[model samples]
Target chain A: MRAAGKRFAGGRSHGDSRVDQFIEQIITGLSIGSILLLVAMGLSIIYGSMGIINLAHGEFVMLGAYTAWLLQSHFGLGLLASLVPIFIVVAAVGWIIERYVLSLLNNRPLDTILATWGVGIMLQQSVRLMVGSELRYVQMPPSLSDSTDVLGFSVSSYRVFLFFVAIALFAVTWLLMNRTTVGMKLRAIMQDRSVAASFGINAKRVYALTFAYGAGLAGLAGALVSPLKSVSPDMGTGYVVDAFMVVVLGGVQSLAGTVASAFFLGELSGAIAFLQNDTVAKAIVLLAIVVLIRFRPEGLFATRVRT
Target chain B: MSISRRTLMRNAAALGAFAGTGFPHIWIKNADLARAAAGEIKVGVLFSLTGTTAIIEESLNKATILAIEEINAAGGIKGSKIVPIVEDPASDPATFSEKARKLVVGDKCVSVFGSYTSASRKAVLPVFERQNNLYWYPTLYEGRECSKNVVYTGAVPNQQQDEFVPWLIKKFGKKFYLIGSNYIYPKEENNYCKKLLAKYGGEVVAEEYVPLGHSEFSSVINKIRSTQPNVIFSTVVGDSVVALHRQYRAAGLDPEKMPMASLTTSENEVAAMGGEAAAGHFTSAPYFQVHKSPENEKFVAAYRKRWGADKVTHFVSEACYFQTYLFKQAVEKLAASDITPPNIRDAVKGQETVAPQGRVRIEPENLHTWLWPKIAQAKSNGQFEILVEAKEWLKPLPYAAYPGQVCTEKGLVEKS
Candidate 1:
């Protein structure tokens, strides 16, 4: 009887270890999913408020990186300090692009996509021509570079900080969208442009603000990621494709859906990558997503219809 | 205000007669000669200026421009000015074929120097063959392809893997792990290495191929650690190389303990990987920045003067520059009435020159150059310090040194 009891105890411990590993993997997945969420939020906001896909959205992120690089290279600012000015500068550029180029094609989404694609090409080539196409490094703040022991796992402080930052940004974005008058106006414009104009909401002004805000978010994401990844002309290409996938997999107009889908895909990809080759893992994830879309039509977290 | 056709013709005739009479005879004669030579000596430069490989292409273009400028300053090739026409392949194979046709049929270039990817090279091969124009490909690629119309100036497997594998075995003894980006170059090269490793009594621990441009590599690194092989034979390229090396370091695997001997990691990739990340890694190539020679010194100095001091990569852009010189030397050797395509091809195959490396000869059978291979270790500053060199130039054997099944399946050989 004592031997059987000891055997039961051993089995319980093994089960506990498996549960702990599963939790750890979930945490890692959520951390990565948060980063993807931040990037996709920027993309979704721009696409939602203004019909422009902004193919140069990724380059705006690149600009943010370069801005941070320039700040450190020139002014000797720390990572956090440099991020502030990068946000401002990149936001200003976004405003200018919106006011000058994107506004010209208000109802023309296809033309806007093409124009922004051209803009992306020009931006990448200009960076290459000016900086000579070499990878530049951004200094990680020493505090964040170190790791902290959490539940017997060595989790990077930088990664934890990134999670908190993303959550904070998400909360702020939610407040801005739900509570503010500008947010209401922007949402109204998105729902029905003609009706919003009838209700005396300056759709143009709302678009400019939304564009700037979207770009600012992208800038922030770029500043956050520069430390993790090297800065180059082509640094953002990989993320752009994944961001598109996230936005589509989620509904194009649903922010909550975007977050949930990003997390879902991120966890799916991360877990599969752990088991199989990354390529095969991605293929499986994509296939699963396609199957889900065929069955569900909306998404995993489609909003309930009030009707 | 409307003039009749007869009146317009008469006025035009009078003006033409007056201008013809007033123009200098020397000027007129020079204009006529220029018109006669308007069919210029055309050379095409196909490079990826817009896509993922643009970084390498930019350096290659700068090197090519430097070569063209120097050649033009020396009164041009064969007394006719070398006209360079450039096209961007955008790193797309289909686009490469289209651009190659544009260069051959539309621009009518005599020879093309380009292609950084094996896919792009394969796409343009039929175009070059059909047009019967010369292509001086300047990037190290999969080594099974040999053609009369293509002068592959880059390193072959024998020049790189044959020497590197044997030397690594001598230093680190018979255990290996192969890691590479999932592409033709890595797949083909790793397969060849497997054959060679087996022949040499070496055991290949594990072979893992990740997708191209894959960023996250913890699992791959974990596999490497679990396998615990003596050395990693790597063929990853571009941004993935950066991610792999950085993750490898973060995972606490010291290259000093278990070194990675890579085929594709050059000084440029080292720079991308950062100095700290790339330090102590070993890479094998036919060229290095720290190669000791007066000619190399001169070439380095001139290159620095032309394109700032900070730009340096140890692959074969300098060799591309040397290829232009080789082409010029061949043209000078022929000294034909007109520098036509057939004559230029014959001249290139027959002529020999003392290159920056040493005396190089183009094998008439395959149209590839025979040159020495240099092994280099990645230094702290993203440059290579030459470690060992084949003192004599190894002949370009596009086929395996020994006749075997692998070589035969690929249809690569020197036909006597």
Candidate 2:
């Protein structure tokens, strides 16, 4: 009995070692997943309230990156200081897009998707023309650039900061959606736009604010990602595709579903990356989603609410 | 708005005649009249204007345009102004093939140039063969593919691998980690390198392949740190190269302890990676920033003047710019009465040009060029400081140097 106990203890140590390794992988996955969530949350909010896909949604992120780059290059503002004005400027741009362009496409889902796709192309090409289709440099501040030791694992400080930021944003977004009157109006409109209009809700104003809110989130995601990745005109396309997949996988109308899907997809992608090539990993994830759709028909956590 | 086909053909023929006489005024007038001409000298430029490969294509477009401008300035070929029609292709092979057909059949272009990816090139090969048009592919590709209708103006495996591998082995004593972007170019190149390294008694510590355009490299970088290789043989292309370099720096990996040698990364890539990101890296290519010849100096000066001083990098765009001049030299050598597609192809095959690198002679057998290789170190300012030149031009042995093909007569078989 003592011998068996000793063997079990040895096995437990080995299993504990593996658990430690898995924790590191999860951290990495969460870091990446958080970025996806920031981008997709904006996508979800716009689609949920306004009933538009906003294909150019990725461009908001691109613009934020460019804005950060321009600030650093021209004004010599450090990374942290640059983010301050970038948030406001990007948010303002988002508000303007909501007011002028997306507002007009309200109630026309197909037209909104096509129009936004066109706008995305135009925005991408305009950046291409201005900056010449090359990757721009976004220097990380020295303090955030280095890695920190976390229980014998080296984790990037920037990644940890990004996680905290995403969590804070998620909380604030939740409060805005659930606690505030505007939040109540948004939920009402998302539930039934015609019915909400009948109840004296200003659908137009709600849409504009919802769109702006989504765009602002995208802008924040872009700014956060700039230090981590190269800033290019076409950088947003890849992220946007992944974001769309996350949105669809999570049940587009459910914020909680979107968050769940982001972490699920992120961890799935990362774990597969460890086991196989990234392209193969992505293909497998996409295939898994396809198989899930065959069984579920309405995503993993989709609600049966009609728009 | 619809015009008759017969009228269009007649107007086209008249314009061709006017263009043939070297009368620009009459040709322009006739060109206006034959606005929908079917037999016009249609040339296709297939490039990636979007996606990951856009950086290389942007410069290639500029170089191609410069070449077209020079050709038209010199009264064009056989007095018929060369008309270049462009298509994006969007970095997709299916799109490349579709666009190739549109250029060959719909536009009736005799020849086309552009295609950075081997997949895109392979995609358009059947189209070119079916339509019997010429394709001048202008990027370094895996050797083994030899087509009758294709002219590969870029470096082959022997021109890049034979010189680069041996030099690296001699200099760094051959403990290599073969890291590359998971694609045909890197896979084939690494396969060839592994065999060559075996011949030299060198060890490849690890061989890793990452997906194209993957932004994160902490895991791969960690793997590299653990391996402790003498030198890293990298074939990572596009934006991923930047990510890898950034991770390497963040991990505090010493460049001297584990130097990197790359095949695809160049000055253009360095610029994208930024000076700090690319500092202390080494790459092997036929061209560098410090090519110090009178002709090269002139070329560099002219390039800097045209495109800003900050933008001139060792991009395929630079090669494409010179390729235009090379094409013109060949065209002038032919000086045929009717400078048609077949005539231009023959001219290009029959001639040689003194390029910025060295005297590049186009082999009639494979339609690839014989050129020199130069090793360069990435400076802090995103430019390559040319370290050593092979001096003499290395003969392009596309199939002969391939490991599997070395013993086969089929590999040595050349086109008649």
Candidate 3:
């Protein structure tokens, strides 16, 4: 293991005050976990509730990122201000894909994967052709641009905001899925689509809304992430893989599971990366997840409800 | 809007050279090559126009085309207009090989200029070597090979690091934190850097590599935070460059006291990260658009006039522009029929050009060029401020780190 905490008088830190690198690693892991939660929340929702392996979920993220870039560049809209509109715009695209494409191949989960993957490629190319492949940047809100001091170590306030936002989004999503009427209908459909349809529920409408919501969440993730990462067509591909891993390890249909798994993966990756290099940390994380999945097939927080 | 205006202007410029299938334009590059098949000399232009590498390679394509157009306008090489048969390899090595075959065997092109990554170069090397054709690679890369069929116009390891290490050590303190993307290129670069540090009596505080496309830098930043290295030698590339810079800034780490000296960060990356995030970092490169010279000014003006004012000319594009001239200078001696790979190769030895970077010439000893290496600091306007430029051209030593290993007119050999 790397040495724990050697004090160095550099950048904000100086003189006698010392912060444990171990504590800083925990914060780093939490930051990483929050990022994972931010990106994978949408994937968790769509895949968990709908049983749709949304390969185009990432494209939706890309689309939102492009939307964010366009808004900022064209209209001088800040990222925070543009979030709702970005969500709406990406949600509409998601609605169209579900209504026109996914609705047709409803019961066939495998074909949805192929079709969504194709859709993702189409979206990426469409953006590339229209926008051109130059790197576009998004500016962060002025307030969160500075770092916040936590236990003598500096953490980006934007990242701290992201952690809160992830929890907030998770809370909102969980409440929406449990306490609301839309949530009731969605759960009814998830339990038995035919029975839900037979009863007074508009199964088609609910599915479309759920998909749109999922896509919007992805859009929000992308919009938030745009400032940190360069906005390009292929940017979402990286997040999509990690999002998939989070969703799978979280137990596909469970929101709580998604949150838990995102945290688990993020902390694991962050702590290991601090000790070892990032590459080995990645391999180790993947290996750990594989072993976890092999033993606990239902994953971390699988819903126990049979019906 | 700035986007539409630039797009409209670029669309008009793209009108002549290559036809594109509508937006996210997968270019049908060979359509117009047939028009010049009769009078113009055929030269293949292989660059990835779409996919991940397109962000950089697209400029290279434009540079090559601009040079070709300039040559034709300036009465061409021996009055024979050069026509480029452009092909998009889509940033895949296998596709690069396939395109190379089609360009050399199918189109009967005299030469091809292409590739940014080493893998793509390696892929296309066999096709060029087997067919006895020439390939001009313009990207600075990890140098270990000496292909007789390829002419490297970019800086090798020594040309980039030899001056960079000592200058950084003298200016910034010597406790260096070596970080890069997990790849052979960064590893090779760090090896050379370590060698230089050892010679300079510098201390290495830490070494690390993150995966490509990685955007998280908090853990890495935490390490940098506590370790308090005097300098951060970074080769973390692609999307990671943007994240690392922004996060470093966000983490309140000042680049002034502990600056990031990079081989990977460039004008393109600065654009991606935005000037505020990128400013104060240093990059060791052979060329920067901010470099003042008559040749560079003219070149930039022409490039902007053709492409768009919004577009920035970078080191690779500069090399691409001059390497085309280097090709023209070599091919001027040959009769149109005498334009085989071997004859052109022999003629290209020591061919000189006053590039945007500075005076550059192909080394007769090796197929690589002698470059004027410079270190530049990123300013707040998405541009570089050229700081320290070499007094003279640094000879490209492909195997400078490995001492005895050298490339000559024949091939790679050990001289110790």
> What order do candidates take by DockQ, descending?
3, 2, 1
Which 10 residues in a row give candidate 3 chain A its minimum summed lDDT?
A1-10
Residue B381 displacement in candidate 3 (angstroms): 0.9
- TM-score-wise, the better of 2 and 3 is 3
For candidate 1, the lDDT comes to 0.75
| lDDT for each residue of candidate 3 in A59-80, tens digit (9 for 90 to 100) | 8888888999999999999999
Cα lDDT for residue B411, model 1? 36
* Fnat for every candidate: 0.20, 0.34, 0.71
User: Runs in model 2 with CA error above 4 Å?
Assistant: A1-21, A192-200, A292-307, B1-44, B50-52, B68-95, B98-111, B130-132, B169-175, B225-228, B400-416
lDDT tens string, model 3, B52-84?
888889999999999999999999877788988
Q: Which ten residues in a row have the lowest lDDT in candidate 3 chain B?
A: B19-28
Instruction: Report the C-alpha lDDT of model 2 over A1-307, residue by residue, as the tens digit.
Output: 3333233223334445455546656876887688788778888788765768788888988988888888888999877788768777767877777677767765476556667887888888899888878788888777887776655556677777877888888888889998999999988887777899999999888877777778778877887778777788988887788888888888767777788888898788777765555667778989988887778755667764432
**lDDT on C-alpha atoms for all candidate structures:** 0.75, 0.74, 0.87
What shift in Å separates residue A226 of candidate 3 from its native position after superposition? 1.3
| TM-scores of the candidates in the order shown | 0.84, 0.84, 0.93
- Model 2: lDDT of residue B216: 70
- In terms of docking quality, model 1 is incorrect
Error of 3 at B113 (Å): 0.6
Q: Could you say which candidate leads in lDDT?
A: 3
